[model samples]
Target: MGFRQRTMENLVITPAFWQDRRVLVTGHTGFKGGWLALWLQTMGARVIGLALPPATQPNLFELTGLAGQMVSILADIRDRDALAAALASHRPEVVFHLAAQALVLPSYSRPAETYATNVMGTVNLLDAIRQTGCVRSVVIVSSDKCYQPRATACTESDPLGATDPYSSSKACTELVAAAYRSSFFASGDHRGHATALATARAGNAIGGGDWSTGRLVPDAVRAFADRRPLLVRHPEAVRPWQHVLEPLAGYLILGERLYQQGARFAEAWNFGPGGETAHSVADLLTKMAGMWGGGATWRRDDETHPHEAQSLRLDATKAARALPWHPRWPLATALQMTVDWYRAHLDGQDMVAVSRQQIARYCECEPKAVAP
Candidate 1:
């Protein structure tokens, strides 16, 4: 069916929609998950997080004081029994699955673990939701790398492909979700399965409180803070860089629409920056250095690395056209927000407050819908 661009004055994420809602967020200890959890809390949603312990020492889950704020269950998504138990216990109506082995470089060394986690982990989560039977909406977050690499931006209907273990695992994940939705949670037969599932394919998400190794923004933040030169591996690689909140907003919007609108919004969707906003890694870093002006510097890594894509972008036209969704910040503004967040954390400021402030600021901006 032909889609028309959706536009509205203010985004309709009403408190009435999320208030007192129970949300289950897998991988809540990671960067994006933590931010999403915090945002849900701001909307008065009861959040239950299930994932392995924080991947890093200074992870966002700990820094934002999420443990004290919500019910946190530390367990691996690969453990099917444990995941099922967590879901049965929480009985959440909304499930946002963000748990995965998210790095391309790490996946090369641990291909088995990557697939076990990203692929089976998804299978486990969906099965658990089916077994428990309380979930109404599930937004499975997958990366844009799940798409076959093309010179042009990828749409939701693009043929699935992957170059590395991480990317391939995400592709497998997308397939898994599709199979599950078709076989079990088919929207037409919601009597027994009664779950609506959608996969969110988003671009490279950049923000602070992310200390994952091999990621550009967090590595730059740490190096800049330590007064050391940041290393650039694939400096020429282009990505659709968006703020952390951008896709999270899309995910929430998708989740809400799925709950309210059902089968109409239950499918794969892309939430990514479009056009000139998608920049190269080198250009992104140069702009980030300017935002973080302690004379922060970066040098090209002479060492050889695993095969990574040189050009990747996401076409979020489906989301922009079918729903009230669009990127809220320019790349520069997102970089500045990243720097500002890291600086605030360094000064020993209350990160919970800072994160809330940023989310509020993002929500205040008017969404500019894209043309179909």
Candidate 2:
């Protein structure tokens, strides 16, 4: 059997199986968030987006016209009262918290904003969950940077900490999640309300509709389209690059388990490509350019290098084994699909439908979990 067929044969149950369920996404307008929202909508879920206004020009959220499809709320996760009100109003059965100050270089410049948004924003949202009393499960979207750097692959048991403000804040958010899971939502606590929570640590995700600044794919695509050489900062830096949908499929599965198993499945998990796919920044760019027709060149720009991790990857064996989650698209397929999306968008095609078509391909290939 092919991987998709094998995955389907081993299937126990999956989250996309949920139909018309009330789902709340915190950063619904962001790149990953927008993709997740679109995916959930395809699964027939009632999605509610809670986030501030889009940050940059040509945001993925607006590009896909997501606000019209779901109940979009303009609010900050840092504001405890507002967050609480939204949660209480929606009474979401599943919650995916993706809101935060996510940039690294920007974090260095505005450490306080980064800390406040990433740390306090998490605290506020978790506290809001406590007040809501109806949220059954939560999937907190964290980063591989949250792993305390060591010489080897990081399992969930590895120390939880960060080297920079952005990473450190995510670490703090994980700690807060663990505390909430163990303390209030401990197995037997009546006040705990049986709320299941899981944190997903994914590495660098690249795909279409990602117009964020300081990211590699969008920068390279724009430069190549403009017939200019792409500037490379820290070209030697290695990362665990995967398509945006790969880890996102993992999160949806985690969210499903959180609702079904509650305390039993509450933990942190990693969602990244296997070791062979992990390569340096320059390596990925070279691959991308070659696949897209070869006129692009990269120039080293050390003066503008962002404060990013030198080398980072996630061990997704736990997800693969437990959730029956494996990356559906190979690195080459991921890059090709990503490039195709940008090309279509630039050519004035319907981005939302184009994005949805990609999603359908992925879900068809998504595996069903095997019995433990």
Candidate 2: residue 96 Cα off by (Å)? 0.2
| Global lDDT of model 2 | 0.82
How does candidate 2 fare on TM-score? 0.92
Instruction: Name the TM-score of candidate 1.
Output: 0.95
Off by over 4 Å in 2: 1-17, 188-193, 304-307, 366-372
Model 1 shows how many backbone clashes? 0
Best by TM-score: 1
Each prediction's whole-model lDDT (CA): 0.87, 0.82
RMSD to the hidden true structure, all candidates = 4.3, 3.6
Instruction: Please provide, for model 1 over 69-123, each residue's C-alpha lDDT reduced to its tens digit, 9 standing for 90 to 100.
Output: 8999999999999999988888999999999899998899999999999999999
